[model samples]
Target: MFQQFSLTHVQFMLTGLGWTIGLAMIALIGGSIAGSAIALMRVSVNPVISRLAQFYIFVVQGTPLLVTLFIAYFGATYLGISVQPIVAIAVAFSFYAAAFLGDIWRGAIQSVPKGQREGAHALGLGRADTLIHIIVPQAVRIAIPPTVGFFVQLIKNTSLASVVGIVELTRTAQIVSNATFKPLEVYMTAAAFYFLVCFPLTLVSRGLEKRLKS
Candidate 1:
């Protein structure tokens, strides 16, 4: 028997929406921490450290995120290690996000004018001091636009968590659609939820870009 899409179904999806937001937050925080290390390593004076960071980025970027998620979730069982779904999703998304964030940050750091570094050197500031005080402040301005853009993308990508049994928004929509036999109504609601989350971030990104430019 087909049931009508009702308020109860919307409430169920709201629960999923919360999980989606939670997952994206986990990915963002984890990714930012790891990505900071990777960015610093990429800019290291040591050739080996820089090359290693480059290699890590290369490998992660080359692999599809779905594959990475599968490896983090399902592959653990094959190796006799138990992994929770949320834990696996966090780890996979973090690792995937780190590669791209690292590169974005690296470009931002490098985009700092050469003359600024020279000026810092003239003032006898060491590399570390110059980076912390002079370079990083400027780099942050450059990084913000892209970083927020990626975060919006990350929020949408959390839908993929459904593959690993995550009851995030998309998964909830699936369940509701199955129960109600109203795929169109269920999925459209899910899309609206996504847009509501993402559109504000898009506006903020644009606002930041304009502010930085001014």
Candidate 2:
């Protein structure tokens, strides 16, 4: 039975792991674009724009990823639109990631000196121009560590997508374990694979944090 842990299962699991990474990368890219827009809106002087951004962040952060997944799956159906599990998961996580990323970036933007903004104003830079030319570059430095750290969280969160029938790493482990009746070995391997993907990102984020401090 122990020998049932064959190379075939290993290859299958590796393929699933690749899907997990691919999904995560998609979420990161999509989330970053959406989240950046939300972050900027959050800091907008216009009350309505700021409120809208705040509301979006509030709803997303307040909901669990699982609940969000259900909404994405069934919600689309109710609206007469068919959605795939992968698309649903990607959409759910993009909004989910956006809320947190927006908040993190907002904090980073706020950390910049108020005097810097005034100085930019003195140089005749408009709000958009000032943010682009002055504030964003500085905020990027502060945001990198947390943003990278969040990638690990995002990767782990991909496991949640398995519930929706997405054939990512966790789902692959479940299928293999059910077949081989070796939950311990199969799941342990899955754990190792997750750690392999995430641990280096952890170290890299820490390194960036240390460098930022210096």
Candidate 3:
């Protein structure tokens, strides 16, 4: 039975792994942009803008990803919209990623000392100028560690995309286990693959955190 683990299965799973990585990259990049916007919005002095951003973060963070997936896929159909699973999963994960990242970045931005902002003001730097040249750069240094850590979570969350039939790594593992009748071996392999993708990131994030602290 062990000998029956064919190269074709390996090939298929490898392809699925690629898709998983691709989707994760998409989510990370798109989420980073959207999340930055939301983060800035959250910190804006405009009460309406801040509240809207807060509400968006609340709704996305409050709901489970599975429900988000269902809504992106099936709910859209109910609303007379056609959606592909990959597209639906990407959209859902992007929004989910944005919410968490927004919060993370907001914290980082806020962590800038009040005195620093006051100093910037004294230097004749207006709010926008201060944020761009002073606050954001410092915040970025503080943000790097957690941002990398969040990437690991983002990669893992891509597994949930499988429920929408996106044929990513988790879905491939399911297919392989169904075929090989070796849940243990297949899942173990999948776990190793996930670890391979994430462990280095974890180390890098930790290292950055330590260096920043120093």
lDDT of 2 by residue, 76-156 (tens): 889999878788888988888889899899989999999999999999999999999999999999999999999899999
User: Across residues 1-214, which tens digit of lDDT does each residue of candidate 1 receive?
Assistant: 8789999999999999999999999998999999999999999999999999999999999998888998899887899988787998899999999999999999999999999999999999999999999999999999999999999999999988999899999999999999999999999999999999999999999999999989
Task: List ranges where model 2 is wrong by over 4 Å.
Answer: 1-3
Ranking by TM-score: 1, 2, 3
Clashes within 3 Å, all models in order: 0, 0, 0
**CA RMSD of each candidate after superposition:** 0.9, 1.4, 1.6
TM-score to native of every candidate shown: 0.97, 0.96, 0.95
The better candidate by TM-score, 2 or 3, is 2
Off by over 4 Å in 1: none
User: What's the lDDT for residue 25 in model 3?
Assistant: 89
Query: Which is the better candidate, 1 or 2, if ranked by lDDT?
Result: 1
lDDT of 3 by residue, 1-214 (tens): 5435577887788888899889988888888999999999999999999999999999999999889888888877898888777787788888888999999999999999999999999999999999999999999999999999999998898898888789999999899988888888788888888999999999999999999999
> In model 3, which runs have C-alpha deviations exceeding 4 angstroms?
1-3
Against the true structure, candidate 3 reaches a TM-score of 0.95
* Residue clash pairs of candidate 2: none
Score residue 120 of candidate 1 by CA lDDT.
Answer: 100
